[model samples]
Target: MPTAHAPGTTPITGVTIDAVLAGRLVRPLFQPIVDLSTRTVVGVEALARGPAGSALEFPDRLFAAAGAAGRLGELDMLCFERALEGAMAAPVAPPLLFANGEPAVMDQPLSPRLMELFASRPSFRAILEYTERALPSVPGSLLRLAGQIQLGGNGVALDDVGVDPMSLAFLPVLEPEVIKLDMSLLRDPHATHSRTVCAVVRGEARRTGALVIAEGIETEDDLVTAREMGAQWGQGWLFGRPGPLDGAGHRYDRAAAAAVRASRPGFHQPDGTPFEVASARAPRLPGTAEGIAAALDRVRHIAASDDAAVVVASTDDLPVSLYELAGQARSTIVLDRPVPGEFAVAVIGPGYGHAVCFRSTGGPELVMVDDLPTVAAVSRVLLNRHTRG
Candidate 1:
């Protein structure tokens, strides 16, 4: 175990470029992020540790050293390669690998390296993680590379934009597949109402047409905050701490046991979110828009109600002439349509609403609701799923 260094302990005052990489450099460590409900480890951020004897072991210090050495691009690529390789070797293979990227790297040719890595591991689908802090001066070429990388079946993500103005601008342009929120921002206890920064992120994330992932979560409170803030996915210590790429415990930090001790083991917050719990097992893949409607139609038919007597609606369905849950009151039931056969007929609506429930099996299973705003909201929830794959 390494002890925390004192102030000015190991300064990278004048390390040359070659000096920085001459030793056992680039140590990769994992951090665990849990699904809000399941309390299971969803993914890990393969953080970079600098050279064995260098003063730049931590992320901030390592990046600083790279910057000073005029080798920021080199370091970024190093970390990306390490993260991809580490993730591939990990025991729990996460579908999403968040390798950090910088504007400088985007300024250069990135596709060849990306293509080469994936060519070696055909099954690995990774996300190039970008943060608000990293803005590309050359937006044109940057977006081109981003698009090219994604077209290869990989993804581009804006990591931890979290309501920042830079991220806000990044959203309309980058349009990344994944929009990650720094869990530290989402976990702010000051997020009291819908007007807080966290709330603002939730709203903006919806319009951007990207999946929201929370990062930096360290406790049950953080996970609760993530759900309350409308984050479909996030990572932190409570879910699963990062271990070795080969499935060993985290070398520097012991997150698994610490989380087990710190977490309250409860799902419901005062806000009533079913946090930190997973479906008893992997859920059936949610039905398609047509499939959902068909299921509802069957339910209403068996209920012996006219289409108006008992409404059949898609998961794409939403409040019409009635109220719907908003803010922390919304509950999304993510389902996978596995063992495809018949869906039990029942109107699934938010609690306390005068929503209809039709019960039946096998029939015209769905009815479509044609409203734009409702459609948008349904699309928001419907498109968001727990499928890491």
Candidate 2:
């Protein structure tokens, strides 16, 4: 069990984790991401930092080793167990925990061993991460698992967004409770190709009714940059480094959560022109499930419109998920659930559905479409509008 093995020495791949895992060598370090407005410690992202002499020191190496060893399942579960255990002791525990599980694992259905882990630890809150993942095409089972997990009360988060449009397209479909920006791609001003990437992500956040977490925040500039762009919560060394959460004082060294309050996110890019930041908007979806039906009529077409996502979301001042198909009325697929609010579109299908809720201007409207095509279609409308315009 070690964190630092001699480099280029016995190369412990994924299979090697077994030798490592057997002796108890996992240390789940936690970094706190404070809310910009409340300034409260809302959530802690559980990072699996290895032991003193383990090869699991760098996450890339650790995971690469796991993959090579075909011990992905074992690695995923062990980290899950350690982090879940760690969270129970975390003082200001956020109801949510961001653990790095990929969509593929969620797709394959947990192995018997992993199922036992979940059964034994039902209280652990996990958000699957897109980092260290090679964007596997998610299938229907993962969607079912998401619905099942949300119903169980502990939820899923779409972690490390800002990687691809595919992830953003899937946001509403998965309807994660938390969506963390891949921090690396998030604040670096997007690419020179276009600025709509940020707007797309923000619109998804606005529409899906989920929390948008910006990760990889290293300095004040990164923190200010993300918050101004409308991230609900933030992670990274800028706010706090990976350390002992309990022994952690009220603040994180010099770069504290308070900075989110002190710094304002800039709408203007480094070049000074206004970056096309997604305008923040409260949802206007209908109130009751019955009302959700009516609400979709007015906006499902809007969801299908040629307007840019930022424009549509800002105009409605609402975020939504599709629930109805042909309804020409304004009703929301609103549910009796306690979900963190963000933006997405869904259409209600004939199942005991959990809604992707939005805070809308006309009231809140929820759409519930139980498939990826429907969700991706809506996201495309948003992306295409801006690109075409």
Candidate 3:
């Protein structure tokens, strides 16, 4: 068990990359990527750390030594392999595994060995993250390489976007699927300069349909700032620090457990009475725009008298239009793949707070108004299940 180092620890010196590699002590820790809207661990970012108590224990020091020794490629490969191994062994399946790749290696032709590694794990959706500082001086090759990566079915994320002038320059060219904002952007989200830069990144990301992730969040205010800046996903100590895969999985497990509890009968209620939870009994709708709109039309008709209804759609069957509608309506949306053939959608209102249940599949998908908080709690459980699945 390694003693977690303080965030303020100074970068250690004197570590030799060769010695670190010879020891084979480069281990991978996973930091959870949380979906702020759902409060779930949607993915994990693999961070490589050296052995505990060693000079190379700090990743910055280890990588610095590797760079000094001109063995950065070797170090990165080691980290990449170890990250895959550890992530696969985690208790909970992460939707995405984020790994760092250096430009020096990525600029060259793709490695057969790396491709084989990816091929071996068909279930893992890996995203290769490249920092702005590491971007190849020859931007063309990097962009071409990024295209190749996507062709191979993996995703690309630009780390620390807006951190450097180079990042801003390459934003349009790379057009990564995920844009990780530099933590500094949130130092003062409202500041004129910060706001301007953030808007630029946000605009480009939105234009490209890229997901924005705010990094280095350490406060509730920071989280809020990140949200205001249009970050759909977030990673930082406030969520959880980088730790062993099992540990990160445990954190996710805890969250899922809480979500399940929140969805259960007595969870938010003080009196310990039970509310009817219904499932969808109707035919499965195709997970298409028209299908979802049709289903939603039924819901809208049922809730015509109320404000809105909580909709739990199949995570595996989620339609882009449905997602957009949920976003527009500000409705409680759960996107879990393994949701049973039918689930529940509830409406709560004026007098009582507990929501009446509706079968997901059948004609009675709408329920009477109940307690608002209870309905919300149930929706969370369904959403949590989606995260876990």
lDDT of every predicted structure (CA atoms):
0.47, 0.50, 0.60
Question: Number of the top candidate by TM-score?
Answer: 3
Candidates ranked by lDDT, best first? 3, 2, 1
C-alpha lDDT (0 to 100) for residue 18 of candidate 1: 55
lDDT of 1 at 41: 52
Writing each residue's lDDT as its tens digit, candidate 1 over 215-280 gives 766667777777776776677655565556675443322232222111111101111101101111
* Worst 10-residue lDDT window, candidate 3: 257-266
Model 3 off-target regions past 4 Å?
1-16, 109-113, 250-389
Q: Tell how far residue 85 is off in model 3, in angstroms.
A: 1.4
> Model 3 Cα RMSD, Å?
17.3
Kindly provide the TM-score of model 1 when superposed on the true structure, using C-alpha atoms: 0.55
Off by over 4 Å in 1: 1-17, 22-24, 111-114, 187-200, 204-209, 248-389
TM accuracy, model 2: 0.57
